[model samples]
Target: MLRESPYPMVSVSEATALIMAHVQPLRSEEIDALTALGRVLASDVVSPEDIPDVPKSAMDGYALRAADGLAPRRIVGELTAGGTATVAIAPGEATRIMTGAPMPIGADAMIPVELTEERDGMLYIQRELKPGDYVHSVGQDVRRGQMVLAAGTALGAAEIGLLATLGITRIAAYRQPRVAVLATGDEVVEPGSERPGGAVRDSNRYALMAAIREAGCIPISLGIARDDIDVQRQAILQGLDQADVLITSGGVSMGTRDLIKPLLAELGTVHFGRIAFKPGKPTTFATIGDKLVFGLPGYPVSSLVSFEVFVRPALRALQGDATPFRPQIEVTLAEPVRPSPDRPEYQRIIVRYQEGRLLAVTTGSQSSSRLLSLRGANGLLLVPAGETTYPAGSTLPALLTGQLLL
Candidate 1:
């Protein structure tokens, strides 16, 4: 029988719910539209006026009245893009218009240059043209008073272009959260430090920093914090002072060097200290004033999984993302695997599309310390508790970590 943990344990769903309940979207900031990529909009962007504002030509062709006879017509003055049409097309007359140019008066259609031949200053229509042919009507794309971009929409390249079309130089979006990453433990040293008798390089903090950046949060490194209680306390306070969210990797589990849990309880309310999940059962969450703090495992893979499961969603929620959680899908197991007895498991797996089905293949070893298991992994096989062995062809839900090869 396994020894009972002193800290109360909760399910993953409960832990996530509690964390999300305490999260509030960050305050909005006005940034230039060009720099708003990947930012969630705080307010709906309404169109001030019609895009294009007037009827424009969709092609470089002749703008002439469709009622004009098929006989040759005199080529009047030319109209280029962005220039107003000063000449009107009367009977037996056509205006050479370029793409995006406003249609000349008395012209209801455009005949593409390829469909007509021009010789001796006269144009002959070789194809039948109908009214309103090849003409982009005013407000065809967007109308005044329309919502160009809805609130909570993450701005991307297409959104930026649309905002530019709407004459929006700047946009109001939720501010990105600043995450402070602190590595703790007496045996842990900086990455460049020489490996003495019994010291391990601090890789968790650097990995957490990159993970925070990937989640769209600004990462602030708090360096390494020794296992001493006083040092850990001071580091936590400093991290809180400079960051909106503090992520400490190490010193949360039941061990002689674990000082983060007790220190957090003394400093702030530790909401929940344990979860019924493999690889990251000792994950802890707390709130110091308005800032959120996450205590993750020291093992590299555990830290990565904990951040992806808890911290990442919280960060996205702070940025007003509508879909904060990673997408989940059902996939078939390509091989047999044993499940974690009373706790759920997040086994990293490489997903492939085979015969129109998603196949899940486990990454080499599931050890929490093996960060390489996450390399090239795009999905996590979510094996629930209460099952021993799952054979191939068994269906289970999986959460996406990256792009799946489908």
Candidate 2:
């Protein structure tokens, strides 16, 4: 039922380049560091003071000069964690120190309590000790006035811990974007609604909403629009008023009921009608003033694939993320596969480890409408159009989407 379009198809690379040319990073804002998880930093964070400003004991042990090893020494005093040991340790003298306690002055070494015996105010070493053993030197982990985190770094648990260590209560971060989602076609009914004859459930609406949330954007559902032209135009205009980007599903194809393309022509400039790619060939990108619009296919699998390939990057760009593309690695194919003759294919694949090598297994049936093709898939094999068939053990670059085998 595919119908030809009047516009010429563009390569995926060319389309990506054109799309990026219009991207401008959103403005920056300041927020509390505790609630800034997954947000991109707007400026570099510098350490105000060196971590562990003084030499500290890495374990509970006796602190003394290494030359006094294996010799009966007088226990001068006991130092616990969080207490300063300003008393100096002379030859044949030792101080009982707890973990994280500052090392006593003039102490060159530490012997763990297990390797020492104490009785009647005297401490005895079980074996010889080396200087600097079990002792953390000053500024060992971090130096003062050093760049702890760079701009555009995504804040995570580790990043938050680093900020806490530096006593930074607030940080400059980019604002999250609001994305509008609209579903098309009268045959698409809401879930739990009465199913009329030949009507299918509207899965794309909720699915795209979850995908938008996963990309760190707030999703605004514009409700379902029938195949009518006026209804579609009104919905598109309303979506533009509330969202930084508009995403519509099921109305960009060449079918007679596909009103999204014609409506966009009257509202704004359509960058391209179709892309030279599989499963998402009918994908459309356009702009109306400062807002961006994307028209994705109606099929479940096609809709998800289009979001991963295009919408995810756009969301990241809005958050001022420098590198937005998914990480790709070369993996060996476990079975034979053929590439598309006219366009490149993004075949769903499961990446596994065998003999210390990463191998890709096809998820079977790359049909755009078959949602099962994406089940348990962690990678997408990018099979180019130049290759006719790739035999077993052939290497190809694949986009990683799920947990890594490592």
Candidate 3:
């Protein structure tokens, strides 16, 4: 059983409930068959009829009745995948059928043509065929009215092929979540645009955009949001109007210029003010009607870290993905790390395999501003608050950050 957090800081479980309460299901859209890969099925798909629609051949050998397996069979007609054979096989007669060809009536098994020699209108069987040998029974792949896919199963190539077996040419899939991303704060600037003095290149927007796309959603860039309330309000509304999720960076901190929290409160109800996670403690999540809004910290590291912890899950839920977050594994600590009593820490650390064991080692610093350290790291050392003085070789839960895919 999971333990309830004792810290007044809203525990991860509580924070998750607060985050999910604001998001609503996205509308559905019909995408082309080829484009359905990685998309989620909006509803359960049941096979209208038996898959294969008929008993078909799984091999190229021969087709015959399973009861005729007792003696040598007669090959009177041949059938391929696209062609149909009208001549019915008698009690001891076998029809030649290639792979994917539907079996004729009274035929129970398929016999390979290579096993029989044919002369004139008669086929001579060289070996005795077994019962139910080559006949792919009707409904072997899928039965009529059988549930082929659950509502939440995201579509993939294999899934598409399975659906095709049921003659499904078109599918109903969950609409992609329209995520709006904005990099706010006067100090922030776009990556490609000309940079003015004192403006830092906007990495959060690009990183967040990539992350959103990886989650199979549509992401829009609202550029940079200035410190003005009206400007912030307009920007927030633009995201609220279209997107199911609105994500912004650089305005939830304690600085006098920070205006996201107050403006969001005025525009809509703020879901949660902050979380216990480090480097992202100032994060804020709110709802503008049905739109879920996340105000992330200005630092690139904090934005990425918090996204993994919060926004990623929200978007995944919107997409109907079964496994929303990155899979976690237990590893031994390569070095000891300290956590503050006030906040839980997600420290970027490198994990290396040594002597067939996973060992995690953190960089010299875990400050939010250190971009190089975070880039060099491959995993996170998750230490809860007030749990300081961990000795080397201790076991802890770590999130893999390198060489991983959703």
Is 2 or 3 the stronger prediction by lDDT?
A: 2
At residue 357, give the lDDT of candidate 3: 82
Give me the displacement of residue 343 in model 1, in angstroms. 1.9
Candidate 2: give the clashing pairs: none
lDDT tens readout by residue for model 3, 1-406: 7543222356666788888765555666676655588898878888899766777888887677666544666668888899855657778787777899887777777767677776665566666666667767778878899998988788888998887666687777778898999878888877888999888999999989998998888999998888898999999899888787899988887777888989888999887777777878878888877788899999888988888788987897787776666668787887777886777788888888877788888887777877776776778778878856788988888888676321
The lDDT of model 1 is 0.91
State each model's CA lDDT, in order: 0.91, 0.88, 0.79
In candidate 3, stretches whose alpha carbon ends up further than 4 angstroms from where it belongs are: 1-8, 29-34, 65-75, 91-95, 112-130, 196-198, 321-328, 331-342, 348-366, 371-381, 386-394, 399-406
- Taking the tens digit of each residue's C-alpha lDDT, what string does model 2 give over 1-406? 6656976898888778777877887888989998788989888998888888888888998889998768898999989896754678999999999998888888988889998899999998888888888898877888899999888888989999989988998999888888999999989999989989999899898989998887778999998999999999999999999999999999888778999988887899888878998879989888888888999999999899888887788888888887878899999999998898888989999998778889999999999989899989998899998656999999999989888764
| C-alpha lDDT of residue 223 in model 1 | 92
**In candidate 1, what are the lDDT values of residues 1-406, reduced to their tens digit?**
6666567899999999999999999999999987788999999999999867878899998998887758788999899996755888898899899999998888889889999999999999887778889999889999999998888888889999998888899889999999999999888988888988888899999989998888888999999988899998999999999999999998888887889989989998899999999889999999989989999998999999999999999999999988899999999999997898888999999999889999999998999989899999998889988767999999999999899897
Q: Could you tell me which 10 consecutive residues in candidate 1 have the lowest summed lDDT?
A: 1-10
Comparing 1 with 3 on lDDT, the higher-scoring candidate is 1
Model 3 quality (TM-score)? 0.82
Deviation in angstroms for 70 in model 1?
4.9
Q: List the residue pairs that clash in candidate 3.
A: 61-111, 61-112, 61-113, 62-110, 62-111, 62-112, 63-110, 63-111, 65-108
Residue 329's lDDT within candidate 3 is 73
